[model samples]
Target: MHVLVVYESLWGNTEQVARAVADKLGSVGTVDVVDSDAAPITVDGYDLLVVGGPTHAFSMTRAATRAEAVKSQSALHEPARGIREWLNLLGRPSAAIPAIAFDTRVDKPRMPGSAAKAAKHELRSMGFGTTVKQETFRVHGYEGPLLDGELERASAWADEVIAALGLGSRADR
Candidate 1:
């Protein structure tokens, strides 16, 4: 199985999670990971697509939110374009390609909503089949190293995704 993992991150927390997911998926098959800014606007050959980003303003980051992040977070590098724009450019994919969406968010009580959920809805609207439910990994704060064990949790989720796709060990191949 070939997989593509794309992500948009401001403080690097979401990028870490994307790498973890891609690394785990790599154990099962070929996986390519790219930042949303660097990702191709089309999904042509991949069998699976995984997209993730940080939650901003209860959903994916908008241009305004990205500007705020750049202005407020001195350590953050300027993002060329966020996942929202990347997804918008990717109108739809062939029905054979399945997708999963994830996001990194503050671990606060009653956090308004999730970017992963919003992304999943968008993917569905674009006619992509989702093999797994949208997932979220928590961060202790806005700029984060990720909450404890989140990377392990993300890797485990990749295992579940592989199983759902009916891909057994690739050792024999």
Candidate 2:
């Protein structure tokens, strides 16, 4: 199966999670990891889609950035578009193939939810089934030193996604 993992990161934390996810999917089949803002991906080309981003101020940071871009008419350092807009424009994929969503955030004692939840909701509206509950990996600081064990957890989560989606071993695709 061909899987596409697209992500938007502020301080690289989200990318790390994306890579770990893609690695696990790679074990089962072909995987492509792309920046969410690069271009709108055609979901029809892949069997599964994984979308992720970073959380800032309790919401996906990329969404605010995209909004800023639209109002400012200038490209911002973050990106011009977000996963939500991309998925909305892509319409629905042919199959109900499962998709997974994840995010990276500064672990705050006050806040529990992550940006991935919003992304997952948007994906569902766009007609993709989700596998493995939405997840969040923690970061130590704003610029981020990802918290310990997050990568391992990401890989493990990917394994779960594969299993939940009924995908076979890596070699079988």
Candidate 3:
């Protein structure tokens, strides 16, 4: 039940959510939460792949978008590579490994489009099975202190994903 939680975060909000999700998943099995660029080239050893990123221009971040975020100087941290580029560079897995996607977006003016949705397509395109449905955590604005309780919700979502997969191996459960 090894899990790989890979993500791209601009303002670190998405990174926070990613860690919270990985924390819950740790009860099930080993979990490695890494930046998208630092992720493995292949999904060979993992049982599940959980991916997340901040929604940029309504989808996964691009080079231009990331540059813009950096230019705006609003991000606490910027990923060296975004999820979009990482996926492109990833190797095609031999099997359709189970996966889920998540994103951080503006909480107030709920927008159209989702990094999660786009990520689902990318993962499926790369032969990964889309297991649990995609989720979107919210932030106050672009560069955000994540809206309160999003971390809790992220952990809960991890448990739900495991349940949906019938993994039934949470350490506490």
Candidate with top TM-score is 3
Give the whole-model CA lDDT for all candidates, comma-separated: 0.87, 0.77, 0.89
Q: Predicted candidate 2: what Cα RMSD to the true structure?
A: 3.9
10 residues in a row with least lDDT, candidate 1: 71-80
Q: Which of candidates 2 and 3 is the stronger one according to TM-score?
A: 3
Candidate 1 Cα outliers beyond 4 Å, as residue runs = none
TM-scores of the candidates in the order shown: 0.94, 0.85, 0.94
Q: What's the lDDT for residue 96 in model 1? A: 59
Local accuracy of candidate 2 as per-residue lDDT tens digits, 50-158: 9998765566665665455335533224655666566656767787877789888776454756678988887787678864699888887555678999999999999
Candidate 3 worst ten-residue window by lDDT: 164-173
Q: How would you encode candidate 1's per-residue C-alpha lDDT over 58-81 as one tens digit per residue?
A: 999888888887788653855778
True-vs-predicted CA distance for residue 15, candidate 1, Å: 0.8
Candidate 2 deviant stretches above 4 angstroms: 62-77
Model 1, residue pairs in steric clash:
none
